[model samples]
Target: MSERTPFRWHIAVFLAPAVVIYTLVMIIPLFATLDLSLYSATETGTKFVGLENFRTLFGDAHWAEQFWNAFWNNVWFFLINMAVQNPVGIALAALLSLPRLRFAALYRSAIFVPTILSFVIVGFVWKLILSPIWGIAPSMLAAIGLRHLFEPWLGQETTALTTVALISVWQFIGIPMMLIYAALLSIPEEVIEAAEVDGITGMAQFWKIKLPLILPSIGIISILTFVGNFNAFDLIYVAQGALAGPDFSTDILGTFMYRTFFGFQLQLGDPNMGATIASVMFFIILIGVCLYLFGIQRRLRRYQF
Candidate 1:
């Protein structure tokens, strides 16, 4: 019988620093937050309330209204990215992957540069650009004779959330594009040659062959978008403030938790309730990932070529 290799003590040594840092920053805080959710502050001190906070969040009318509003907004935010960003990304990737495409790298870099920029910067810059008073959007529209279409989009309740979501899409579309681009490039040359022999060329080739093989990549991008979008805070906060205003039309779970945990203008901070909100967000993300991993991923794997 073959003997097992000796334990790699050096491997553990190399991993120790990263493990320690992650535990300190991520793991410990996660557990602490979860623990904090079970208690509520009292005049005397604190009281263990079990799931009472969660009940208040969902059952109480005031909290329920805000919670549902934030929840629905978050859902819309994710849906926009899924519908617009990913499809556009796929299209861009298909074009960039074309063999004869010129300056593909330049196009890729330009598109991807926004993804690397700080969300705060992107949000703040867009906010300034869209300002009704002195912003360039009105001027740019007037230049093209479309000035009549201009409005205070960022300040309007009806358009504010959608505008922010599209801005997010514009900034992050490059991620799915790059990921799918890599997936496309990884397709075996032999497969392309075989498809060519079969007279499956151009869009027909992509629709049937490339698309099927890249379904797994799309699935991965979708899940990542879900997790990231659900956890999104920086951009919305930067553009709309802590209240996520225009009458809280842009508030998502992250912002909701932030306001609850940290306090806003008049709302006093309630750490226990805030922790409950955060816990709920964590579970929402968890369920989503699990659904994708166990359910959608299995189906995606079947289409892998």
Candidate 2:
């Protein structure tokens, strides 16, 4: 072997494919979309409108109201997932991570089955289950003398958004559960033994020791939940359609963008408006991620051991 160090072309070679693909697929498209938002389609094709498209999105009463409504709805959707999914996932993960838990693998597989399913499949399956016509929700409720409680949850203004949010939570809970479980498993056995020796057993050990150590993992899951929930589209689209129907009660930014871009029933498509909506969503996600990383994550001191 030569004494001189060889040139490190391997690193560049390995990264080239991923870098090229990302630039072409993600970066180029993102910039293109941003550029597209600046131009509005007219009779003679697209016209440069600068910030006029954005102003129309936020200033026009008709568009502004819908945009704000969708933004708020997206926030609520994200909040519900954060509240429901993470806790349930953590609880299930904690339970399964226990040393003596029976059939742990089977339970994990069963719980994770939903995550393996496509969004289209999950949405349609839930839609059928919750459908007023052929859905089993009413009958299932009736079986327990709670039939009176059933009322097309997916079709009502009061419950439509929340019901859809919960459906999303159910379908994706496996991700956090798997992540937390992995974190829990990574905890050193010696540390647990030490905790046991100090009379910290069972729930005490989990809450006082394991939880603190795994907090970084929880933070990661929380941020992921925020990002995914805010950007969600396929589930709601498949279940409620692009209009987010029943008086647009379930309308979120994703569906709103779809409706703006494609038009539905009466409304004509507006590409400039659609791009503006998309730009807004991108910023919202960016802000959320920044907050999580700089605000929440900074305070969560991760332990090496």
Candidate 3:
């Protein structure tokens, strides 16, 4: 018999199953959606309409207004998370990772518990806590002599989006905390000791040494937060429903797409329009990721040590 080739095909064979699954599930669906966006359904079944769906999504007065509103609302939601969540997460992580801190593990575990929860559970739990019928939030505010602060925050147009953003921040803070904590832990003890010996202790050491070394990690966390915030959906959908009620004050791209594609209370679904919306969302996410990777990430200098 001829000698067998030395190189084995085992690695490719093992990887083939995963690659096939991903291609079929993700890649195929994405392309199919794109293809469907080019055609509109009618009594005669789907007919090729080229760019008509996109034109209507962007140019028609009624559809365009709702599309823009949802798009802007999504942007606002993302901005709030970036403004509130990352700083708070970084602060908590820094404090918890501090040397000689007591009960650090317990605090970490408690804070991270929310992140492990399902979006539906977290949404309903917060909804109940904030509901006027339950009066839990008002009761707490009254206890602090701030009863005037109480209102149906989630039902009000002014506060609904902010309330939802804060809820998301609360749920996901643990992610950044854990990531940053791990990065902090990776710093060598010898380096920290050297900083202490150089008359740099306490906050000074952290600002000068620790902060510089962890900048790369911070950059990474910021990009991750950016992507996650942009892609957010489930919590808002669960808490506010697909309509994102109170006059659509809480509507984001995801809910908007659902309403447009699947129809709501009285409206009819439009698959082509839905596909257009999905395509827009895909581009938005792609742009944000590219900006982070090429613009922000390239400028960050990761230390070799």
lDDT of candidate model 1 versus the reference: 0.95
Tens digits of lDDT, candidate 1, 79-145:
9999999999999999999998899999999999999999889998898899997859999999999
100-152 per-residue lDDT for model 3 (tens digits): 99999999999999999999999999999999999999999999999998989
Residue-level lDDT for 298 in candidate 2: 83
My TM-score estimates for the predictions, one after another, are: 0.94, 0.93, 0.93
| Clash numbers, per candidate | 0, 0, 0
How far is 195's C-alpha from truth in model 2 (Å)? 1.8
- Quality of model 2 by C-alpha lDDT: 0.91
Per-residue lDDT value at 40 in model 1:
96
Order the candidates by TM-score, highest first: 1, 3, 2
> What is the lDDT, from 0 to 100, of the residue 217 in candidate 2?
96
Q: Tell me how far the alpha carbon of residue 72 in candidate 1 is from the true structure, in angstroms, after superposition.
A: 0.1
Q: Against the true structure, what is every candidate's RMSD?
A: 2.2, 2.2, 2.0
- How far out, in Å, is residue 107 in model 3? 0.7
Candidate 2 per-residue lDDT, tens place, 1-305, comes to 66887889999999999999999999998988888899998889998989888999999999999999988998899999999999999999999999988899999999999999999999889888988999498898999999998888888999999999999999999999999999999999999999999999988888999999999999999989888878888888999988888788899999999999988889898877888889888888899999988988888864645
lDDT of 1 at 158: 98
For candidate 3, what is the lDDT?
0.88
Clashing pairs in 2: none
